[model samples]
Target chain A: MSTAQRRLDIEEVGDVTVARFIDKKILDETNIQIIGNQMFGLVDEDGRKRIVLDFTNVEYLSSAALGKLITMDKKVKAAKGKLRLCCIRPEIYEVFEITRLNKIFDIKKTQEEALEGF
Target chain B: MRAGLVEVGSLVPFQLKRWDPQPCGEPRRPAEPEKSPLEFAQEMTDREQFEIFIPSETAAGQAVQDRIIQRLEARGFTDRDVFGIRLSLEEALVNAIKHGNGMDPSKSVRVCCQIDTETVVVEIEDEGDGFQPEEVPDPTAEENLERPCGRGIMLMRAFMTRVEYSDHGKCVTLEKRRSVEGE
Candidate 1:
């Protein structure tokens, strides 16, 4: 979904919190880097809003990146916000399904749809 | 089984094979059976021998995998062989980069994959201080069922003949004995 370096950004959608991760795979060493797990946003309240992760640029994700998503999901749910993944790449989606994590996450085709979901 | 050379950046799990499915990692693969996991690593040099540097970063795992796969394929590596190698190498490289270098993209990680006359050898080194292998929790053990830190190590060990840590634990050397062609 993404087309550049591994990165993260923040945005707001209809009261929803969106954290955009550059599709760059955060390798343990070279090729990429992992800043930390809390790279995603943490909202403090629950409304007709959502906490979305824009995977539009993320092309490959390792377990480390997956770990960050898990940690972020926990924080989002704790704050009563839903963790929604947007524009996930098909290959990475294969990885998620292989790891059986597809069942635990809210994967959406677009940001607008995820926001509308709530 | 003949004169062949491949790289994984180069990848660590150099799954040496000729035919078998789980061929690369098995301890007792036949001489050019369905596959093989031959090793060819030397320990005279420092841990730096186990490092690598990839300049351009690509987020596409398939592309990354394809790059390595095609390189190996030209040298006679099959799809199954690549899969096993990818799994083991990914685990080792991931650890070497993350735990060893602390995930610093600026600092390159070292990886040495040797597929020579009789074995498949993979050595990985990071630019960070190493830990005592003993101190790391064992994922296969009952106590570490849910922890994710050491599962890769366990999996790597399973897929390779041996997994050893050095450079005070920051460098890892993985190997699988090589098999000859129809010996």
Candidate 2:
């Protein structure tokens, strides 16, 4: 998907591809579906290995969106790549904590930190 | 039209009293009750209420969700409160539209919400054969943490003050107390 059509603002820091979510509320199903496809295409199609998801723009996220992230995580792992998440606001971090996804994904406090060691 | 009204304040499951579907199948907003000017002014910002029925499509569901979020913001719900409510509302509505009703256009979902100074209550009911909540696996378990599907119920429980399922899980009632400044 083109950057205009994708819900993410994609950037590259060194070898890591930093994809920032553009939507503050990632609740709508259609948007989530589009976002998921775009994110998945980075690995399945683009074959980019090191990935960092920047959540600085996201204010609200639903479980369906999280499902997409989980699938993305699995895809990255299957491709023998790495994925890191950064800039998640406290409320969203609490969501990760509540669902115990905090344990499954490597989370960082900043984009600089997420890009390191990748 | 079924005459049984589903009250938003109640935890018990209540059947919706059927009314004529709104034109174009838009979400039906309940008519405002008659109130004197003074009473209306006094209660204008103190409480907000809506009773909506939408078809079983996620796109149709967004209108109902956006209205409730706007109501919460208008009533001065803290950002955190809105975040959780917004998340929970999405999960609940999707559960109703997808899991409960199977996205059957013939099925409908009812959302009744009441927002006041101290509390926000929302009741969502779907027209379908309900499932047992207990049958859902614990998503937080070590083996299940990576699973994406079952976390909605858990997040709703974590975010809301009270989450209750009734009428064989066809109806879910969500409540949240407004967060205090220091507490």
Best candidate (score: lDDT):
2
Residue pairs that clash (backbone atoms under 3 angstroms), model 2: B2-B18
Residue-wise lDDT of candidate 2 within B10-124, one digit each (tens)?
3222323432222224587865678764554455445556688899999888888888889888878888888899899999999999999999999899988877788888889
What would the per-residue lDDT of candidate 1 be over residues B32-87, giving only the tens digit for each residue?
Answer: 44433433322211112222454222332223334544545555544444444566
lDDT of each: 0.55, 0.85
A15-105, model 2: which lDDT tens digit per residue?
A: 8899999998888778898999999999999999899999999988899998999999999999999999999999999999999899999
DockQ of each: 0.11, 0.76
TM-score against truth, every candidate:
0.50, 0.84
Residue A72 lDDT in candidate 2: 98
User: Candidate 1, which segments miss by more than 4 Å at Cα?
Assistant: A1-6, A29-49, B1-90, B97-110, B115-183
Each prediction's number of clashing residue pairs: 29, 1
Query: Any runs in candidate 2 off by more than 4 Å, and if so which?
Result: A1-4, B1-45
